[model samples]
Structure formats: C-alpha cells, structure tokens
Target chain A: MKGIRSVLYMHWRSVGSWVYIPWLILGSVFLINYGWRSFHQDSQSTNDVGNMVIFIYLFTVAWIFNGQLFAFASGLSIKRMHFVLGSVMAAILISIGSSLLLMLLIVVENMTNGWGIDWHTFSWKVTQTFAYWEQFAIYLLVFLCLILLGFFLSSIVIRFRKRGLLVFGVLLYVFFLVISNTSVNGFDHEEAFWTWIGQHGLLVFYSLIPAIILLLFGCYMLFMRRAIIRS
Target chain B: MHVKLSKVRKAYGKNVVLNDINMVLEKEKIYGLVGRNGAGKTTLLKIIAAQLFPSEGTVQVNEENPFENEAILSQLCFVKESQTYPDHFTVKDILLTAKATFPLWDETFCQALVARYNVPVKLRMRKLSRGMRSVVGVIIGLASRAPLTIFDEPYLGMDAVARQYFYDQLLADYADHPRTIILSTHLIDEVSELLEHVIVVKEGRILMQEDVETLRAGAVTVTGEKGKVAAFIQQQHVLSSQTLGNVTNVMIFGTISRQERLQAEAEGLSFSAVSLQKVMVHLTDQEKGSA
Candidate 1:
C-alpha cells in the first residue's frame, strides 16, 4: 500500500504540478484573444486565434513531454516497468483533461456567438451534430489520442537520451505542421496521398488507430526496459 | 532480518562483478563488509537491497525473492555516495517525501539530526556541497529506522570529527534498536570497534566471516631476531611479517601460550596482541599477493 501511495505521490508531483503551466499559458492566450476580439468588433479575428492556438498547443505538448518524461525517468528504481506505467498513465490523463477543458471553452464561445455550425465541415459538424455528452466523449477520445502521441515522444526521448532529441523535437513539429497545412504533392494532383487520406472512409481511421496503439505499446515497453542492466 | 545469498553471480558483457557468492546475514547484529574497491561490496549490498537482480542464483530475504518484492524492500534502507534526487526538490522536500514513502520513517529523528548536523533544510540538494549532501544521506539512513540498514562509504566527505560523531550516534542508536546493520567502509579501524561480525571479501569471494572478538582473539604478534621469528612463523599461519636491521616482527593467527611466549622472549623475542585493523590489512595484503 505504501508503494502504491509513493507511486501516486510521485505522479502527482510530476504530472499534476506540471499540468498547470501549459494550462495557464493556453488559458491566458485564449483570454487575451477573447478580450482583443471583443474590443475590435472583428469576428474574423477569432479564426486566426484558433489557428495560432494549435502551435501553442504543440509547444505545450513539448513542455509536458519533457518535464513529465524526466520525472518518470527519475522515479525509475528497481521496478522500472511499474514506475514507467504510472508516469505514462498520469501524463495521458493530465493531457486529456487539459485538452478537453480547452475544447469545451472553444465550443462555449462558438455557441454564445450565435454562429451556425456547418455539418459539411469536419470540425464544425462534430461540434454541432453530436449531443452534449456524445460531443464531450468524442473530444475526450481525440484528447486521449494526442496525449498518447505526446507520451510516445517522451518515451522515445528517454530511450535516446544519449542522442540529442532536441533536434528530433523540432523536426517532428515541422513534419506535423506540413502534414496539416498541405496536400501530399507539390502540384496539387488529385492523386496525392494527403487528398486520399482526407477523403477515404477507412484510411483515416486506420492511420489514427495505429498511432494510438503504437504509442500505448511504446509506453508499455518503457516499463520493461532495464537501463541498470546496461550500466 | 536475515539475507541468504545463494550462488549469486553478476556480470556485464565479458567482465564479472560478482562470482557465485554465497553468504548469509542473520538478524540483530552489526556486520562490516570489508573489501577493496571494485571488490563487489557495493554490488553485494545492492543485490541484498533488491536494487539489482543477480545474473545467476538467488538472494532471499524473509523467505522470498527481493527483486520487485516490496515487502522486503520496504524494510530496507540503502545509502550510497551518489544518491540522486530531482533538481526541483529542496533538502526538506526530499525528507518530506521520504517520510511519506517509508512507513517506519521517523520524522522527529530526522528533524533532530538536521539540527544536529546544521544542514540547511531550505537549500536545494544540488546546491549543497558534497560533504553536506553526505550529511543529508547519513541523516536519512539514521532516521529511516528500517529493519535492515546498509551504509556504503557513508562518511567519505566527512572530517574526522564528524565521522566520529556519526560512529558514536550510530552505535548509540543501534544499541537501542538492535536491527541488522551492514556498514561497508574503507575506514576499517574507525568502525572496527562497532562491528560485531566481519565479512572479508576479496576478488568477489568471501575470504572469511568471523566474530570481531574472535578474529582479534586469534591474532598474536611476535618480535625477535630474524632467525627466531622465521622459525616461529614457519610452524604457524603467519599473516604478515616486518623486518628492521636484525629484528623481525611477525603477525600470525592463533593463540600463543605462555610457554611459547616465554621461550620466544628468552630468544630476544617480544610478544603483543594484534589489533583488528592490523589483522585485516595483513589478511587483505596476503590475499592480494597470492592473487
């Protein structure tokens, strides 16, 4: 029971304390944007804020990834697997909670503005068509997926502390940004992989599911790793 | 609080650190684990603490395997020279965490030790000097009050005065709590007075395990002319020998009777009791030369 208590306490110290830093940063950015938009009477400015917030969210992921991961590594003693599981699970829960709360705020803002959410748009349809609990559940799932991605990256960093992961972090950011911003081809060909990924019925689910499963598996492997054996 | 290590072996790639070492540690006594640097003292302690798993054989504590076994480890406290903690935690925070983690942790004892050592509780662990950090470690080890407490070179950065204080406090506390305590230190003479049992380790093998009093009782030193000393040592197990001009002093294990003492004295010989420190050094040196 004391061991469990120690694990939970360590998790709270690492993930709980760090959860506030990114939440505050993202919360403040949203507050400032809401104040600016209200002052300027410009409805279009809100979309720009939403887009900018994505990069901020990514940075928050990097921050949470770094701090939570090092704490996880520090907590590793005799039972490396148990420590790693506690850490990765704590990180996942915190990241999901943070993302869900922020998404709820965004949806509230949209509803208060009397805007009609369009079903044809992927983001707007999910926000509008689903019932309150269903919408919340969907957002929670998406949040869990992203948090898993963050945890996966953190585990990779631990595995490669000898190699500079800072470079890898920057490259990952750029890769995600490019994938989100453009089609897979330069000439805008209809045969582009990104076009197919965006339109296909099964490809989207397939790609997303594997990423989630791989991340969870990576977290599992982190627990089983024996760094002391190497030492 | 007994540890039974059976055929324990640890290796790294091509090099072996501990080799088929079998040892038994009983309850309610102080044991001094003596060995040269890299002679597997720390490795042996770690194995007993369950911080490491042996490559072969078994280390059993309380009739169960130690690795991943919280029941045994919860009762054990191990203090190392380079113990690590997070950079964010101050010395007070680490102690607080330890208090929460260890069921038998004595916070009052820790606080008293903090005051006695004059440690700055508010200071970050990383900012503290090496000596001060060692003091913090000592405080933790003493205050943990675990059933099995193992301290490995605990006073490395401490001065003679502080080291003496540590030994005194350790003996004083141990007198009241009679738990199993194993101290691995290079300062043999300073701790020999407190040790109940001595386990001499050499080249990953246990050279000897005997009560300290018995070890001391069995050693005798004889000084005489070189010829007489040589003749006397040839008939006994000579541990060490020293020569000066025509005089030779030989340290040998086993008792020397009054008749033998009188005979040697008549042949220009001097006899005296050998201390534990002298015996340990001689034994270790003898081992090294043979190796």
Candidate 2:
C-alpha cells in the first residue's frame, strides 16, 4: 500500500499540470459559446457538444500518463501491480472529482437557465430529465471507461511499440466499416446503435462498469506484467 | 544482502543477450562489473535488480525471488547510464520521488551531494546537461543507501574531477555504511582501486570473478631480454606478449611464487605490475581471439 501511494504521489507530482488543461479548454469553449449566444440573443436551447471535450482530454491524459509513468515507475523499482493499482485509484479520484464538478455546473446551469442564453453546456438536452445524482454517476462511469480504454490502448503501444498501434488502428477501422455497412431499411446501423444507447441512457452508462474492469484486466495481463523500459 | 543467480539466461527473440550466468554476490563488498558494450552487463544487472526477468533459471535476492517483491525491491537501487525522467520533472522532484521510493534514502547526504555537484534543483530534467543528468543519477544512487546498489555506467558525461569526487564519496560512504555495491563501467582503471572484487564479463558470460588482490597477485608482466623472458615464462599461461628489438614483455596469467620471482629476477628477468585495465583489455582480447 505504501508502494502504491508512492506511485500515486509520483504520478501526481509529474503530471499534475495535465489535470487542468481539460478544464482550461472547456472554460474557453464555454466562454466562446456564451459570447456567441449572448450576441445572437438565441433563446432556443443549443445542444452544444463542447462538453465532450473533457472526455477526449481525459482519454489523452490517460494515454500519455500510462505510457510515460509506467517507465518512470519501473525505474523507481515499483512493482507492476502497485503501479496499475495506483493508476486505477488515481483515475477513480479524477472521475469522482470531475463528476462532482460537472454536477455543480449542471445545477448552476439549470438555476441560471443555461447562463441566461439558453445554451446547454453542462446539462445536455438528452439527459436534462435525469436526476443530478444519476447524471453524476453517468459522468463518472463514462470518465472511467474512457480513461481505462486509453490505458489499455497505451499499454498495447508500450508493449509492442508502433506496430501495435498500427494494428489496432486498422482493426478499429475495419470494425467501423463493417458496422457502417450493416444498415437496415435505409437507416445507418452505426447511428441506429447510438440511438439505442441514447434510449437506454443510465443503463448504457451502468454497463460500462464491466467494460472498465475488462479494460483494466487486459492492461495488466496482456502488457504490464512483463513490461520493460525500452529507450 | 546475498544475491545468487543460477543458470540465468536472457534472450530477446533469437538473439541471446546473456547465457549460462551463474554467480553469487556477497554482501558489503564493492564488485566491479566490467565488460565491453553489448556484453550483457546491463541485462544481467536488470535481472538482479528485478527490473527484468531471465528467460530461464532463477535469481535469488536474500534467498527470495525478487520479481514484484516489494520487500526485496525496496532494498535495491539500480542506476542506469541512460536513465530517463519525466520531461516535466525537476531535479528536486526526482530527488523527492527517490526519497519516497527507497527505504534508506538519506536526504542530508542527498542535499550534500547536490551542493557538491552544484546541480540546479529547479531546472527541468530535460533542460539539464548530460553531465548534470548523470550527477542526479549519482546522487540518487549514493543517497538511496540501498543494501544492493547497482550503478551501470552512472557517470556517462561527468568530468574527470566530478568522477573522482564520486569515487571518493562512494568509498567514504561505503566505509561508513557497509552495503553491497556493483559498479559496471568502462573506465576500469579509474575505479579499479575502489573495487574490492572484479567480475570480468565477456560475450554474455562471466569470464572470471576474483578478489582484487587475488587478481593482481595472479597476473604479472615480465619484461627482459627476449630470450630470458621467453625462458622465464615457459610454463606460465601467457595472456599476451610483445617484442621490440632485443626486449620482450609477456603478461603471465597464473600465479608466481616469491622463490620463482626471485630466481627469475636473479636471472635478469624484471617484472612489472599489471594495471587492472590492461588485464581486462588483454583478457577480453584473448577471449575474442579464441572465439
């Protein structure tokens, strides 16, 4: 447990600056949206996808931190299991923090009527009917899922280098291509799949718990167990 | 701590880096791991440090497997020549992390070393010069005070004075706090005196492991008239021999008794001490010739 704490502390010390970049970007986007909405006097609620920026940034943070910190932790004689556990715990803490912040922002947005410009940045039009706690849970689960996916992908790259990323990219492209081709009655199958997810809402987010576990497991067993620092 | 490797072999794909490596490293001794580049010195050290796994066989640290064992890892520190730090990490950050990671970290000694080396604690690691980076590694290795500390060419771009100071500091600290230290370096002569035992590695295998005194006592260079030198070392294992005009110098590998030396000197064959560096060169050269 002490080893895990050390790893956690090291990670925070080294990459703590990265934690704020997403917020900075989100804040900038919010300002721009607010300015545009105020200037245009748009009363209709806008379904801005700007909030998705945080998720993308979180993914990037996870990918970079996993790749770099794994080598650094190994240099410190940290056990692989401890490093993995520390990373997971860090991700959980970040997710919880982000979820709470998003929840507060959503409450503020609702109370102020979308910052008085009818722009939905925190509370999307699709999920405004859900309770605040449920939204927080969804955000937490989504953050964890994306972060773990990033970790799993980064582990693949660390273990096999560029070739692994190339292979994974090709596989992902093929998967999307197959999904796009499997259309039914003129409706795009990929869009239909997302529509199903949108309809399920909380159920879809809740299902990510198993996926997060699987990604964490794959990261450890497939790449991290015998990983070595390669210059 | 006692470290034992039995039949340890490490291979990358079909390219074998280390093979049939079996050795015991006793506690509280400074052992020099001298070998040429690509001679598997780093691989062997990594195996012992638990940063890597051998393809076959076992490595026992204090009679326990060290892989993922926190109890063993906390007592070991391995400093590499090309040690990498996070790009944003300052020297102070690294020192703090090392202090937290190593159980026996000496912050006072670390600060003293930092002051002695004049390291810029606020500078990012990437902003530091090569020598400065090396100094950081040296400070961590020395201040960690680990039971089994291994330095694989920790002084890469350090100046001569700094290197000498590092040697002095290492020796002084070892005297004060006895622990096993393994120094792998190409500058054999510079560290020869600091080493208590020398482990000469050649082509992924240990050629010889002997005490410093025993190695020095066993090898000698006989210099005299060509015919006299040739006659004097007739039964000895000659590592190498050179002739210029009527003079000859032959490096003999086996021991020479006091009576034999006196007799040889009386016969006008003079002897000179062989530097550890020369011995290592000739030894590796001999291995290459045979191979």
Candidate 3:
C-alpha cells in the first residue's frame, strides 16, 4: 500500500503521451468525413466510417506492451507487485476515460444529429438501441474487457519476451487445427463455430467479461511476479 | 543498512554467470565494485537492489530480503546505465517522477544539481545528448538520497569534465549525508580514492574484497636488479613479473613493512604502489591465462 499510491499516480503520467492520439484521429475523421461529404450532399449514400471504438481498442493494444515503464519503474525501486497493480489501475483509468470520451461523442452526435450530415461513427447500436446509462455501461464493459485482454497479452510477452508471442501463436494455430479437424456427421467445425457466434454474439461476448477478468488478473499476477527487467 | 549475499549463483539456463559468491556490504561505506566487461558486477548490483532476482542464493538488504518488500526497496535506489524514462518525459517530468519514488527526495538538491549540470529542463529525456542523459541519471541518484544507493555505470556516456564533476559532487554529498553507496564501474582508478572498500570480481567470482588501505598495502611492485627482484619475490605470490636485461620488476601480493622496505631500498629495490585498477587487470589476466 505504501508504494501503491505512487504507482497509481504514475498511471496517468505513464499514458499521457499516448491517450490523445486516438481521439485526435477520431475527431479528424469526424470533421473530415462531414467536411468532404458536406459538399457532395450524399445523404442518400451510406457513409461507412469506421467506429471510434476501433481507435480506442487499438490504443490499449499498443499501450499495454510498454516494456520501458517496467524497466523505468524497476530502476526507481518499484516492487513488481506494485507495478502490476499500477498497470491494472492504468488500464481501468484508460478504459473509463475512453468511455467518457465516447459518451461525449455520443452526446455531441445526438445534439448535432450526426453532425448534420447523417454520419454514424459513435452512433452505433449501443447508442441507438440502449438507454444512455446502459450505453455508457456497455462501452465501459467493452473497453475494460478489451484492455484486460491487452494487459494479459503484454504480461505474457514480458514473462517470455519475443518467444512468448510465437508460442501463443503456435498454440492457437494448433488449437484451431484441433477444432477444425473435429467433425460430426460430416458437418464442418468452422461453419459450426461461425453459426454459434452468429446466433449468440452478444451473449458470448458479454459472458466472456468475467472469464477475461479472471484469467487476465490471475495470469498477469503470476507471470509478472517473476518478471525480469529486460533491456 | 548492511547487505549480505551467501553462496550466490546466477545463470541464464546453463551459462553460469556468478557462482558461489559470498559478500557482505557494511553500512555507510562507499564500495567500489570492480570487474571486467562481463564479470557479473551489474548482475550482483541488480540483485542487491532487488531489480533482479538471484537464481540461487539469498540477498539480504538491511538484514531483510529486498524482493517485493517496499519498505526495503524504498530504502534503496538503483541507477542503471541504461535506465530509461518514458520517451515523452522531459527533464522536469523525470525529476518529479524520481521525487515521488524516493521518500528522502530533496527538491532543492535536485534543482541545484539540475542547474549545476546545465541540463535543459524543457528538452525530452530521449532527445538529450548521451552525456546529458547520463547526467539525468546522476542527478536522480544523488538527489534520491536513498539509504542504499547503487550506481551501475550510471555515467555511461559522460565526458571527462562531467565525470569529474560527478565524482566531486558525489564525494561532497557523501560527506554531508553518510549512506551505503556501491559504485560499479570500469573506471577503478578514477574512483580509487573515493572508495572506502573495494570488491574485485573476476569471472563472476570475487577475486578480493578488502579495505582500500589494505589493498594498497597488499600488492607492491618491487623494481631493482633482476637477481634481487627475483630473489625477493621467490616465496611471494607474484602477480606479474618482467625482466629488462639487467633490471627486473615484479608485482607481488604481500606486504613489506617499513623496515623491510628500508632494507630493500638499501639494495636499490624501489617500491611503487599497485593501483586497484592494475591489480584488477593482473588478477583477471591470471584467471584468463590459467583457464
């Protein structure tokens, strides 16, 4: 607990350089998408602009594997447990911050009615179908789960270095082979998998939150406890 | 404030680096950790600082294991040569971060050091010149004021002038605030006078650990006529011997008292002290030749 406070404070500072890029890009996309299409007045043609969540999700993927912070904090004599705790706190904060930004974008979109061009970036299913509060909760959950996945991945990479990712890929490929090779009554496995996801996409993704949290937290603690300081 | 290591052995898979190293670092004394390029000096220092885990042995800092113990870790500061700050961090950012990490953080001292070193506070750490980057590390190590501060070649790219400034600052600061400081560096003679105790590590094994005075007393170079030098070193552990026609010089690891030196001087056997750096070289070379 003595070091935890310092670690928690370091979280925002650690990601300060990285937190703005995604939103800036999303904002540019919003402005440009409207500005370019405004002249054309293509309200009839659908604008397939990428979701802001794409950028938000990608931010964690890059931010999670920052080995420099580990070495930096270690040199400063931060305990491994404290570093991991701080990493979790950083992930939570980033996820919450990202959710808030998304909420702001949604509010702006609703106020401006898709920026007056019928653009739909943050106006996805969660914005239209769910209540405002539920929308924020869903956004928060999606962010937390995605960032948790990133954290778990970064932990694996740290524990094993470059070979860890290679090992993971191989194991995943082997698992896919095993799954695809398994067939019943001449039915295909890949087809069955996509059919399951198609029927229960929301249920499967929502249920995975607890599993991801449990696995990520447990594995990150175990691996990072013994993590070495790599140059 | 005392650190101890018992039968410490470190290896990566089968490539053993340190083996059977037993050492005791007493409190409030400046120690010089001297070794060759790959002689496990940095590894041993990291283990003591708990930035690294020892493969097989125990490292006790302040009579307690430093690993995962924030109370002990907070008491120590490890300034690595390759210590990295966040790429976006400016000098101020690094100083503030260091301040938060070290409980004994002295803002005034840090500010003074910043101005003394002439490091630009607005420039990002990654963009600074190599020497300036090292200056940042030096500033942090000095101002952190941890009870047990370990510097593993923290002045990697510093020039001679900056390095002298560091030595001067370090000596001045250590005099004002006594603490256990271990400086692991290749520049042995540059810091020979500042070191109270010297630990010479050769090929992962401690070649010797002695007080600086004792080390200076242990090895002496006897130069005189070839016959007299050879005769005097016949029963001594000769570290090196060279003959030049009618004259010979030999370095032996045995103390000659004042009377002995006076008698030897009567025979034209002039004596010169073997520096810690020269002793380290001869010791490491002997090991290499023997192996």
Candidate 4:
C-alpha cells in the first residue's frame, strides 16, 4: 500500500509540474471557439459551423492530450496502468468541465440572438448520436483508433531518440498512403463505408478488437519489454 | 543485520567485471571499500546495493534478497557520484521527494546538514555547481541513515573543505546513531583514519579484507644497506625493493617481530610503518603488472 501511494505521489508531482502545458491547450481551445463564432457568423452555411467546431475540438484534444500524456509516461517511474488511468480521468474531467461551460455560454448566446446550428448533425459526425449505446460504441471506436495512433507515435518517438519526431512524420505519411492504396475492405467509396458501418455495427465493433490488440501489443513492446531496460 | 556475498560473479558481455568475489559485511561498522578504476569496485558496490544483480551466486542482506524487495529497499540508501534528480526541481523538492520515499528519513538531520552545508533551497538542481551537487548527495546519504548506506565515489567533485565537512558530519552522525556505512573511494589516505575496516578489491576479486589497524600493522618498510636489506627481506613477501647505490628500501608485507626489529637495528636498518596510500598503490600496481 505504501509503495503504491508513493508511486501515485511521484506520478502526480511529475505531471503536475507540467500544468503550464495544459493551460496552453485550454487557451488554444478558447481561441478556436472564438474564431469559429466570428468566421461563420455571415456564412450561408452557418448552420454547418457547429459541426466544424465539434470536429476541431475533438481532433485538437485527441492530438495534443495524447501526445503529451505519452511523453509524460515515458519519463516517469510510475506504472503504465496508473499513468493510463490517471490521464484518462484527468482528461475526462477537464474536457467535460470545459465543454459544459462552453455549452452554457453557447446556450445563452442562442437564447439572446437566436443562433441556429444543427447540434444533431454536429454530434452525429463527432460522436454517433442515434442511440446512447451507438454513441458509446462510436466513442469507443474513436478512442481505440486514437490510442493505437498514439501508441505507434510513442513507439517510434521514444525508440529513435533525437531524430524521432522527424522520422515519425515521414512514417505517418507512408502509413497514410499504404492504407489509402490498399483499400482491403473494398470500401473506397464513402457510401459503401457508411452503409457497411450502418448495417453491421458488429463489424465496426470487431474492427476495434484488432486495433486494441495492436495498441496493447505495441505498448508492451515499447514500455514493458525487458530489452528496453537500459544498462 | 549482516550482509554476505559468496562466490558472486558479474560479467559485462564478454568481459568479466567481478570474478569469484566473496566478503561478509557485518553491521554497525564503517567499511572503506577501496580499489582503482575498472577494478570492479563500483560494480561490487552496486551488486551489494541491489542496484545491479549478480550474474551468479547470492547476495543476502538480513537474510532477504534486496532486489525489488521493498522491505529491504526501505533500509538501504545507495548514493552514487552522479546521482540524478529532475532538472526543474529545486533542492527543496528533491529533499521532499527523498523524505517521502525513505520511511526512516530524519528531518532534523536533513535540516541540520542543509544548514551546515549552506545549500540553496530555492535553486534548481540544474543551476547548482558540481560541488553543490555533491553536497546534495552527501545530505541525502546522511539524512536517510538507512540501516545500510552505501556511497560510491560521491565526493569526487567536492573541494577539500567540503569533503572535510562531510567526513566530520558523517562520523558525528554515526557516533550518535550507528548504521552500516560502506564508502567506495580512491581517496584512501584521506579517509584511512576514519575507516574501521578496509576492503581492497583488485582485478574484480577481493584482494584483502581486514581491520584497518591490523592492515596498517601488518606491513613495514625497512631501508638500509643494499646487501643487508636484500638479506633481511628474504623469506618475506616483498611488496617492492628499490636500490640506489648501497642504500636499499624494501617494503615487506608482514609484521616485524621484536627479535627481527632488534636484528634489523643492529644491522643499522631504519624502519617505518607503511602508509595506507602507498600500500594501496603497490597492491593495485602489482595486480596490474601480474595481469
């Protein structure tokens, strides 16, 4: 119990020292919010603006938060499970809190000036909003996808030392090209992709299984492999 | 609580670092661990500290394996010369972390040593000079005061004044609260007066382990006429013999009896005790030349 607590304290102190980074992330989110409101205010497709805002928010957090979390875990003595749980908890709390405050502000603005943006369409694109279960399913899928992406990034980033960041960019571009060219699932068309996703939600669920397996396997190779212990 | 290493072997890839080493470290004594560079001194200390595992044999501390054993780890403090702490953290933060990690940490001693050394509390570790970094290691070792405290060449960068301060504080602290302190260093002469027992390692093996006074008493240098000194050194382990014309200086490893002393005096021989520094140099040099 004492060892566990000590590990927790150490992890908290280390991450807490990087509080400045999170604040910068939050500031970027606010800037995105203000920019979206102003730029789409006069557009004929103003209704589509909310959808874009949601996409930006989700993508930004997924990219920045996951990257910083991986770096934090690499440099600490804490266990991987503890780090994963702590980061998830902290991200959920901060994202939800910020979203709620922003939601309230949006509501007040709509009530006063009658702004009309399609919440259903925005939510549908960022997160499936057909049913609670379907929404949760889509969220899980996105999480697995991003985590696998993060795992791959972390593996290469940490393994290559100084030139890791540059190498990762090139590798990601190559990976993107490979997936685009292969089209192994015969869903090169958007209609086919969505139709397949809609008909066989189970298939979507099954796709996540492999992504999760790959993610965990990559994590083990990067962080827990005995050979990673440097003399 | 006693520690023992029996037939412990450690190898780095194709090169052997520690070969058939054996030693017993009793509790409540100040042990001086001495050896030259690449003599497996740090490797041996790391093995005992549980920072590195031996490739063969066993190292038992208080009848328990020290590696990953929190029960034993809590009682051990291994401070190295280049002990690392986070760069952004201040000295106070490092002290706090140490206090949190070591269950038996002494706050009073920590504060006293910080005050004695006049370390800057607010300064970040990266900004501190080399001597200050050594001071930090010294403070941690003293403040931890774990049942087993091992310091591996921690005073290398410290000046003479700071080194003296550390030695004085260490002795005073140990007198008031006794603990097993193992110090691995090349500065044998400076610390010979403070050590209770001396363990000399040569070529990855235990060359000699004996009480400091016993080791000092066991050797003497006899200088006289070349022929008489050469005859007198017969049947004795001669560490080294140098001849300049008729005068010869011979260092023999073994005590001179009263009769032997009388006989040497009658032959107009001058005798003196061998300094610990000279003995260590000769011992290491001989091992190297033999290899």
Q: Chain A alone, TM-score for each of the models?
A: 0.60, 0.86, 0.82, 0.47
Best by TM-score: 2
Worst 10 residues of 2 chain A by lDDT: A179-188
lDDT per residue as tens, model 1, A139-208: 5555555555555555555555535367677887999889766654444664666567666634566466
Candidate 1 Cα misplacement greater than 4 A, ranges: A15-17, A23-43, A46-82, A100-222, A225-231, B254-259, B286-291
How much lDDT does each candidate structure score?
0.69, 0.86, 0.80, 0.67
Model 2 segments more than 4 A misplaced:
A171-198, B286-291
Residue B185 shift from truth in candidate 3, angstroms: 1.2
Prediction 3: B-chain TM-score: 0.96
Per-prediction TM-score: 0.78, 0.94, 0.92, 0.75
- The order by descending TM-score is 2, 3, 1, 4
Judging by TM-score, tell me the better candidate of 3 and 4: 3
Compose the digit string of candidate 1's lDDT tens values, residues B1-291: 888999999986778988978888899789999877888898888788776678999999877887766677778788877566666567876777667666678888888889888999988888998888889878878887888888988887888988898899889988887789999988888998999999988778788899999898888888888988898777777887789999898788876677977887888878888877777777777453242
lDDT of 2 by residue, B186-235 (tens): 99999988999999888899989999999888889999999989888889
Q: Taking the tens digit of each residue's C-alpha lDDT, what string does model 3 give over A198-223? A: 88766776687767777877887898
Worst 10 residues of 1 chain A by lDDT: A114-123
TM-score values for chain B across all models: 0.94, 0.97, 0.96, 0.96
Evaluated at residue A90, the lDDT of candidate 1 is 62
Clashing pairs in 3: none
